[model samples]
Structure formats: C-alpha cells, structure tokens
Target: MKVLQINSTVNSGSTGRIAEDIGHFLLQQGHESYVAYGHGNRPSSSRLFKVGNEWDRRMHGLKSRLFDHHGLGSVKATKNFIRQVEVLQPDLIHLHNIHGYYMNIHGLFEFLGAAGIPVVWTLHDCWPFTGHCTYFDRYACDKWQQECHHCPNIHGYPQSWLIDNSRSNYRVKNQIFNAVRVMTIVTPSQWLANHVKQSFLKTYPVEVIHNGVNTDVFKPLDAPGAGGRYALNAQNYVLGVANVWDTRKGLGDFIRLRGKLDASIALLLVGLTRQQTDGLPKGITGVPRTESVEDLASLYAGAGAFVNPTYIDNFPTTNLEALACGTPVVTYNTGGSPEAVEKGVGYVVEKGDVDGLALAVRRVLVQGAAFRVNCRLKAENFYDKNDRLQDYLALYKRLCAVASHQTVYDGLQN
Candidate 1:
C-alpha cells in the first residue's frame, strides 16, 4: 500500500521523530511510504511548502504582535500543497500534528474533504478543536466548544490575529472534516481520545494507540560510567526529563520537590542550560540533554526512579523510554503520563501536591528494583515493536480496502 504521512515536521523535533519512526516502520513492512511536510530546521522534511506570501511577509511581524495562527497558510502556499498531493496520489493520507509551520490547513482540509478516500488524522494536541492554543491545560475554556468568540488564547498559537478567528476556523474544520466519509481520529492516549469524543468533533470515531519506543536501544546498561553516576550517597536519585524546561513540563514542581527531598537524595534533570540550572539546590544535578539514545539509557538505568511532572501531555514517549529501560516513574494523577505508569510500574498522586509527589517518589525508591521490573514488563506487553507496528500495518491495510471500495463506487457512478 502507498501511504502519505502529513505533518508539520518530518525528522528533528519530538513529533517529527515520531512521524519518521512511523514512516520507517511502514517501510520495513514492505509498504511504500512517503512523508510530506514544511521546510523547518527539523531532521528530514520532504515536499516543502511555505506558510504564506509577500503580504504575509509584511504582516508577519504585525501578526506576531497580535496572534499567530499556526495552521493557516497563504492562499498560494495552499494551492501548491494541493498540487503536490494530487501528484503523489497516495493510497491513504495519515496526518499527524499540522500546527507547526507550513501547509495551508483550511485549503488542504477543504480539498481533502471533497476528495476523501481514507484519511486518518492523529490529534497530537488540542489545536484542531481550539481557536488558537495547542493545549489549554486545565484552563477549562469552553469558548472552543461554543462559537469560539472572545477566545482565551487568541494571541496564542496558530492565529495571532488581534481578533478571534475561532468561529471561522471551527466552522471550516467541522464542515471539512465531517464532509469526508472515510475520516477517523487517532489519539496517542485514551485521555486525548476521550476529549475528542466530548468536543464538537463528537461525530468522528476516536481510537487510542500509545506511542512505542525501541527496547534494544533504551534497555538497561550494566556499566554506568558514561555521565558519571553517583554511588547513591546516603540517598536515592529521582530523575526528570524535558525537551524544554517550560511551564507545561512542570519545572516548578521539580524545584519544589528538590527543596523537600532529604539531603542524601539527588535530583537529576536533563535539557536545561547551566544558567537555567544554577539556582537549584546542591544535590540536584543538571545535565544537558544528550543527543545519543544509548547514553540516555545508561542515565535512566542509573536513576532510582524517573519522574514526569508534566501539567499536560498526550502519551509521552519519554515515559515509554524510561519504562523500557526498567526505570520506575512517578507522575501526576492527571493526563496520559500516569497511564504510562501502570499499577506496579510507578506511583501517581494528585496534581501539584508536592508533598504527595515527594512521598510517591520515596515509595518508589524504597521498592525501586521491583517497580523497575514492572515498568519494563508494561513496555514489553503493550509498547513492544511487533504490537505497535502490526497495529499500524493493519490500520493502513484496512484504509486501503476502504479506499479501493470507494474508488470502484465512484467509477460506477461516473
């Protein structure tokens, strides 16, 4: 089957890496796969398309001052993308996050909705339903559910227009999406899937598929001399990871947790600048994010437990990687991160309760080895290579059958 994957990115960043992984998986299974995306500094972007035109160029600074509509591109950019799609003639179009730079979403969806064969859209965030922001956290803004007038995150992502274009985007997306006969929504976590079911997009069928990681690469390391592991000086180590130390990842909680930890306990954080890490307590070690996956495994294996203090998430791959490496996780009792930590795999507590978080971390440290095994076990049972790859292959083949059936029906009508 020939598959076309549509996303804002292809290779470099987190979501781009995910799209690439899926593409490679499909290729290894003897299926023809191609990825289309915008030209970013990201790893391997093919089928480049610009976001806007000359008018856009003049208005971009003004727009940033107002709001940035992430998905909406210029009319010319949209037309070019449509022509590209027509030439590719993919059997099925699988879309990941479209919020990144590139592609005219309004035009592309309208065209796809009209030309629908089989389209599977993965909701990587709340951008599709929201007026602007990719995620709302627990902001609980119902504006997107309604007409999106007076949107909360108007000057947020996607559209940074001074006015609320929520109603228009919402209408267009709903009309285009619902018009397509073979459209399905796939979310990385059940938490996200449930939200999709509850939104204005209630009509679309939503399915859950957790992201997977390679076990061979993320496995335990017997010798931990790479980053210089501590000998657990009278206390255990609690670890945290963030591609960025943004508020969304709950860096505040990490600071608070470190303050409450016993002196012997160590806190290790990855992906922070030295300037960013300077103010933390003495025992908390700040390590720059490693580009090497093998090096990451050694770090995870050395930790007494892995902690993910994310305020919002949709199936974090980091959790999967830690679990694959037999590292116990302590996460909030909120979104999908907790799902990554099964019963014995790790601990989950109320969100923002530092005392509870610290206690949970302590509990995992106490029975750290057993919890570590459970983490690895969970990965083996759910996110192993064969299971995830097979699921995607089956989904693609099913879409192919549907597309063929639709083609025959269209021919008969003609």
Candidate 2:
C-alpha cells in the first residue's frame, strides 16, 4: 500500500510526530510512505514534500489577518500540491492539522472531492469544524453548532485584524468539505469525537485513538547527577511542561499554586520561551524550551509529581511521558487529559480549581515510591507508541478495502 501523510510539519511537534510515526510504520510493513509538510525538520526516512516556504507562510498569515481568509490564501502553492498528489496517486491520504497557513484549504478540498480519494483526516483540534478559532472551549462558545457567524474568537489564533468573514468561511468550508465522498474522521480523544459528532462533520464515522508517547526515550533512568542538576535534593518539586507557557496551559494556575503550597514544595516549569521565563517569581523555577527528550526524561524522573493545569487540551501526551518516566501525575480534568491518567496512577481536579489542584499534588506525593511503578505500568499498558501506530495501520487497511470494493462496483455499473 502507498500512503501519503499531510501535516504542518514532518517530525516536530505532536501532530508532526504522529505523521512521522505513521510513515515509518508503513515502511516497516513493506508499504511505500510519503509525507508532505509545511515547516519544521523533515524526517530522514520518509519521502518528503515541502508545501510552502517561510515567505509563503508569512504572506498567508498576513492575508489571513487582513482578509479573515485563514485557509483560502496560497492558491498557486496549493495547485502545485494538487498536481503532486495526482502524481503520487496514493492508496490513502491522511490529513492532520491543515490550519497552519500553508495550504489553501479550498483548493485542497476541491481536489479531494474531484479525485474521489479515500481520505482519513485526524483532527488535532476543533479548527476543521469551527469558522475561525482552533479551540472554542476557552471561550465557552456554542455558535459552531448552528452557523459560525460573528465568531467570538476572531481575535484569537490565525487572528483577523480587520474583517469578520467567519460566516462566509463557514459556508464555503461546509460546501467543499462535504463534497468529498469518502472520508473518515479521527480524533485523539472521545471529548473531541463528541464535539465532531455535534458539528457538520457528524456525517462521517468518527474514531477515537488516544495519542501515544515514545516510552523508550521517556522511561525512568537512574542517571547520575539528575537530582543535583535540578537541585532536587534540597526541595520537593512539582513539574510542569508545555510547548508554551500561557494561561491556556495554566501558567497563572502555577503562579497561584506558589502562594498556596507549602514553602518546601517548589514549582518547576519547562518549555517556556526566554521572554516568558525572564521574570522570576519567588517560588517557581523556569526552564527554557528544549528539544532534548532525554533531558526531559531525566527531569520527569527527578520531580516528585507532574502537574498539568491546562484549561483546554486534546489528549495530552505529556501525561503519558511523565507516567513513562515513573512520575505520578496531577492534572486538571480538561478534555482527554484525565483519560490518559488512569486510576491509581494520578489525580485529576476540575478545571481552574487551584485549591483542588494543589491538594492533588500533595495526594500524589503521599502515594510515594510504591505508586511510581504503577505510573510506568500504566504507560506501558495504554500509551505505547508502537501500539498506537498499529491502530492507524489497521484503519488504513479497512478504509482502503472499502474504497476498493466501491471502485469495482462503480466500474461494473459503467
């Protein structure tokens, strides 16, 4: 089988790693694989197709801001991509996170509808269903259910500075997206699957496949100097990691925890930008963003507990990573975060409940040394990277079989 995976990046970020994993999995199974991505480092094994350059990205972003055309720009590049897809003639096309200002969504969907390709779209966020924003949970908006006009999150990501074209964008997206005859929807969490069922995307079958982490890299290590590097011996630390530190990821919640928690227990935050980490609060230790998974694994092993206070998330793999490192997790009950953290492995508090969050941290710590083994076991049982990749391979084979049968029937009729 020949597979072509489309995403914003090839090997970096969560979604990119998913695409790369699928590519490598296909190759190992004696199938051809290709990856088409917008930005970031491309993996060495996969046949890579670069969608657009940095200039194209900047221009598309500008156009989106001025015209409220988040996905309608970059026409020429998208047309070229259509030709490239035609050449590949993949057995299946897997799509992930197309809202990164690279492809002209209108052109891509039009091609898919015309070509009648078997498509599997893994929705990493709610952007595909919404008019403007990737996430509406933070805003508590329900307008996406009816029609996404007068979008409340227009000023958010892929921000539109001038016009409100959500009504038009919503209409156009529905028309083009529904034109594709064969498409399957995949979500990383049941919560996202439920939301997709309530939206225009409900017409298709929805599958829930939780995201996985590379357990081998994230596994517990008794490395020398792990504790001393972070000064772990002197203080009890609660660890938090994010690609960015902001209100969405509970930066403010951590700040609030500092005042509430005992002075002996310290807060350690990783993956902050230099600017974000510049200001020093009395009780929190801020670390800049890192690409080294090994470093993160060591940090996770050293910390007393991993705390995720995200207000909105879709099956965060960070929880799995922490668990893989044999660290107990205390996370806010948001989206699929609590789902990854099985009973006995971690604690979950309601969103924005700072007091509850702080208590959960202490509760996990009380569970102590015996509980760390449970965390690692949970990761091995549920969040192994190879098992999750196999799930995708199985889905592809099933969908391709159906597509083949339908093609044969259509040919007979003709």
Candidate 3:
C-alpha cells in the first residue's frame, strides 16, 4: 500500500511526531509512505514533501490575520501539492491537520471529493468542525452544535483583529467539508469523538484511538541520581510539565499549589522560559523547556508526583509520559486527563480546586513507590505507542478491502 500523510509540522511538536511515527510504521510493514508538512525540519526518511516555502506560509498567516481567511490562503501552493498528490497516486490519503496557515483547505477537500479516494482524517482538535476556535471548553459554548455564528472565540487562534466572518465561515466549511464521500474521522479521545458525533460532521463515522507514548525513551531511571543531575535538592518534588505555561494550563494553580504546600515539598516545573524561572517563589524550581526525551524521563523519574492542572485538553501525552516514567500523576477532572490516571496510579481533583490538588499531591507522595509500579503497568497496557498505532493499520486494511470491493462492483456494472 502507498500512503500519504499531511500535517502542519513534520518532525517536531506532537502532531508532527505522530505523522512521522505513522510514516515510519508503514515503512516497517514494507509499504510505501510519504509525509507532506507545512513547516519545521523534514525527517531524513525516504519520501517527505514540503508543502510551502517560508514566504508562502508568512503570506498565508498575514491574509488570515487581516481577513480571517484561514485555510483559504496559499492557493497556488495547495494546487501544486494537489498535482504532486495526483502524481504519487497514493492508495490512501491520511490527513492529520490542515490548519496552520499552509493549505487552501477548500481546494484540497474539493480535490478529495472529486477523486473519491479513501481518506482518513485524524482530528487532533475540534477546529475542523467549529467555525473559529479549536477548543471551547473554557467557555462551555454549544454554539458549534447548531451553527457557529457570533463566535465568542473569534479573537482566539487563527485570530482576527477585525471583522467576524464565523457565520460565513461555518457555512463555507459545511459545504466544502461534507463533499468528501469516502472519509473517516479519528479522534484521540472519546470526549472529542462524542463532540464530533454531535456536530455537522456527525454523518461521518468517528473512532477513538488514545494518543500513545514511546515507552523505550520515557521509562524510569534510578531515582536518586536523576534529581542530583538537575541540582535538585533531595526533597519531595511535585512536577508539572508543559510546552508552555499559561493560566489555561494551570500555571496559576501551580503557583497556588506552592503557597499551600509545606516548605519541605518542592514544586518543580519543566518547560518554563528562563525569564519565567528567574523570580520564581522560594520553594519552586523552574527548568527551561527541553527537547530531550531522556532529560524528561530523568525529571519524571525523580519526582514524587506529576501534577497536571490543565483546564482544557484532549488526551494529554504528558500524563502518559509521566506514567511511563513510573511517576504517579495528580490531574484535574477535566477533559480526558483523568482517563490517563488509572486505579492506584494517580488522583483526580475537581478543576480549579487548589486545596484538593494539594491534598492529592500529598496522597500520591505518601504511597509513592507502590504507585510508581502501578503507573508503569498502566502505561504499558494502555498508552504504549506501538500498541495504540496498530489500530490505524487495522483500520487502513479494512478500508482498503472495502474500496477494492467497490471498484470491482463498479467495473462489473459498467
């Protein structure tokens, strides 16, 4: 089988890594695979395509900022990509993300509809269905259920400084997106899948395949030596990790957690900017964001507990990583986070309850070693990267069989 996967980034970020993983997996199975990405470093793999140049990407972003015309810019670049797609003649076209100011989505979907090829779209977020926002949990908005107009999150991602075109955008998206006849939607979380089933995209089937973690790179290290390398004091450490720290991700809750916890318990956060670390409170240690999975595993191995206070998320890989590293997690009971915390592995506190968060942290620390073993067991069973992605291969085989049968039937009728 020949497969083409498209995403906004190639070898970095979560989605980019997922795309790369799929490409590599297909290659291992002795199938032809190609990856097309908008930005970031291209992997050294056999077949990788750059969708647009830096200038084209910048122009696309500019158009979106000025006119709220996201997914519609970079028309020529998208057309060129389409021609390449036709030449490649992939047996299956798998899409990860089409946003990020790189593709003329209307044009791309139109080509898919006309071609009638089997397409599998893995939605990392809800942006494809909604008019403007990628996430609406903070607002608890249901405007996306009926129609997306007068959008409250117009100022959010694909941000527009002027004019609200959500009503028009919604209509345009509905018309273009539904045109594809042979498409299946995949969501990483059942929560997002449920939401998709209630939206205009409900006509298409939705499958839930939880995001996975590479266990080989994320496994626990010898505990004592791990903290010493980072110059961390030998005290109980509550760890939090994010690519960025903001209120939406519970940065404020971490601050509050520090104030409430005793001085003996240290609060350490990875993925903070140097400036953000400079004036941190007395008991809190902030390390800059790391690209090294080995470094992350060391930090996770040394921690007493991993705390995730994110108010909005879709199956966070951080929880999986922490568990894979044998660290117990204490996460908020918000969006699929608690799903990562199985029995005896972690605790789930209500959202925004700093007191409850503090107590949960204490509870995990008290049973730290026992919980560590359970965490690793849970990760091995449910969140192993190789195991989770096998589902995709199964789905691909089923779809290919169906398409082959249809082709034969059509030939017979003609």
**Residue-wise lDDT of candidate 3 within 145-178, one digit each (tens)?**
8888888878888898886787777778888999
On a 0 to 100 scale, what is the lDDT of residue 79 in model 3? 94
The TM-score that candidate 3 achieves is 0.95
Where's the lowest-lDDT run of ten residues in candidate 3? 226-235
Q: Which stretches of candidate 2 lie over 4 Å from their true place?
A: 223-227
Q: Determine the backbone clash count of candidate 1.
A: 9
Ranking by TM-score: 2, 3, 1
For model 2, residues 24-118, the per-residue Cα lDDT tens digits are: 88999999999998888745478999897889999999999999999888788888988999998999999998889899998899889888778
**After superposition, candidate 3 runs with Cα above 4 Å error:** 42-46, 223-226, 233-235
TM-scores of all candidate predictions against the true structure: 0.90, 0.96, 0.95
- State how far residue 83 of model 2 sits from its true place (Å): 1.3
After aligning candidate 3 to the native by TM-score, how far in Å is the CA of 79 from where it should be?
0.9
Candidate 3 global CA lDDT score: 0.86
